[model samples]
Target: MGILLRHIFILIIIGCSLSVTVIKTGWSEDLLFFTEQYPPYNFTGPNGKVSGISTEIVQEIMKRTGFAYRLKLTPWKRAYELTLSQKNTCLFTTGRTTERENLFKWITPLTENPIVLFARPTSTIKIMQLSDLSEYRIGGYLGDAAVDYLVTRNIPVETVRDDKLNVRKLQGGRIDLWVTGEMAGQALADKTGHDIKKIFTLTAIAGGIACNLHLSNLITTRLQQELNTLYQEGFIDRIYQKYNPDLPVPVYKTK
Candidate 1:
């Protein structure tokens, strides 16, 4: 009976070792992707799953790459910070700005959205130049490239946690203008039934997947290649059409 017990104990130890190995292997194979609640780009749908144009694009790319990944909807600031600090982590629909050029390894030009200023439809706000923005109370969201662009030019901005809130603020006369992406602004306005108009186009910006500085070049290269194929095959155009049939699809570049 003692001999039988010893044999059973040995089998248990081997089984425990195999389980640990499987767990570690699964963990190492998985990648984590983060994004904010930017609509028609990346957002939590009514069914509680993350689904949008950019989210769909990323999912297809990962499927092509055969890499296991987790997509999480988080605050913009937290998502950006996690991509910056965590390995095997990435953020999608990130603006590829000159100031951020050196911070992360990029798989770029996933989106070519123009940053713009929005205001109430009835407001007569003329913005012929960037300097004119300093005269009004400009509202924006935290960790957005549009806000950074304005702040770098010495323009003061009121920031909030969500860009959607700015639409309400504009309606309430709390802010004179709101700075955000053209697509995002329109989506927010339409969803909230707010009447807002684009007052001025700030600048055209390309957005993409931003990976940590320490991420493997292999993974970045694979994602870029897959994205290029998607663009060439018109898969991306279909995604854009599904979201907004009238909006022009963002051009993607191989380089």
Candidate 2:
């Protein structure tokens, strides 16, 4: 009986050790990050590696939290779908909205991304408010929050898979207005060699990191705390300065 009890105690010790190991390593194993080719926020470099403002912020969060992850630069639609359906998955640079508020656990307000409507230089379109866009066909990218916002407002919009196509469509007069972020629109315009001018500001929204519902609250909480620390310590400010020296650092509100 003594030997049996000793064996049972040893087994208990082993089990506890295994549990601790699993707890330590399981968070990293379960987390997968998804992003897209939205420049200045999340995009691929010439070497095919993910790097951008949002990516840098997320990397700092991960580094501080000690969470290991694999980030993939995927199509926006696929990345959004995977984050919606998969467990322990996260997507960055996601716009936080009322419709998407309850869908996932959000760690938010990473950076300011004001949505704007742009048009060709010689176009004679006047848009003073959101209601003025009803008569025009706006071009946007698929799986973008701006597209969803327009649809919700019953605005007419044509969506394509690539944002660069929207710039071309606007240039060719295929679409009256191109809806995109201020910074993003400039980047796409520069890339496509099109000089598009902003017509109206639809809304000013900050982007965030959205995690799957199945992700542990503990992990999310730690990440949120670390992000808050980043903001408080001006680490995020330095990152923004590295990307856009002329612009002010974005202030993210903690949830």
Candidate 3:
């Protein structure tokens, strides 16, 4: 199920009544958004609609800021390409990296994601340093920052289009290691109904939300400030608890 780039110019004027509609005071049909299934963060619903913690946060910003936007679930590469080529388009739940820092005029920050490395529990491999696992095969998703971060260093790693496949493959003894977020990996682990603890290891790493460079500086500044505000107000932490009640997440700190 691939969502290709189609410029749907349909106006989705939301949060407005007839009285406000007549005045036409607030409007900015200038935003396009994209996402992919990176579960616990973003995922497709049973009804095939987009909904997750990240989506919820983005929706909140939309409601508060009145940024006219469209969300699409597509292959990461496609979404990234669209965001790069099309002005006013933004991709979310992207890792903040040195390579991509200058590319997108980021919306400061939107949410928090902790980058991590996971492994089957029974595996004898214990990693204290990234170089320690260089001799073994590592599995990561295509277009995922981990793959790019590792592959660029000439490390031996495999790329899978779907991260779930990596977990399944790891559980089946097809791979020696898999890298992903602890939260999402655990969610998939549970969804698969497998005792993953007997099956994975997790390493704490960096992840967050970013937008395309096309966004205005004002939006970027406001976005960052709002993230701080949301955290201070306990909104993000509440969202995390709603999605994950028990386990701890690096990004969701206690107030």
Writing each residue's lDDT as its tens digit, candidate 1 over 77-187 gives: 998988889888999889999889999999876788889999999999999998887789999999899999899889999999888899999999999999999988998
lDDT tens digits, residue span 131-238, model 2: 888788899999788888888998868999999999999999999999888898889899889999998888877688999998878888888898899888888888
Q: Can you give the lDDT of residue 20 in candidate 1?
A: 85
For model 3, how does the per-residue alpha-carbon lDDT over 1-255 read when each residue is reduced to its tens digit? Answer: 123222232222343455466444323455677888878778998888998887888878777776667888888888888888876677877776777878776643444445566767766776777678777777888877766767767776788777778888888888877776666777787788755542233333345555666556666666666666777787877887888776454454432
Order the numbered candidates by lDDT, best leading: 1, 2, 3
Q: Could you tell which candidate, 1 or 3, scores higher by lDDT?
A: 1
Error of 3 at 224 (Å): 3.2
Q: Count the backbone clashes (under 3 Å) in each candidate.
A: 0, 0, 8
C-alpha TM-scores of all predictions? 0.87, 0.89, 0.77
TM-score of 3: 0.77
Q: Check candidate 1 and list the clashing pairs.
A: none
Q: So what's the TM-score on candidate 1?
A: 0.87
In model 2, which range of ten residues has the least summed lDDT?
A: 246-255
Question: Which residue runs does candidate 1 get wrong by more than 4 Å?
Answer: 1-27
Best by TM-score: 2
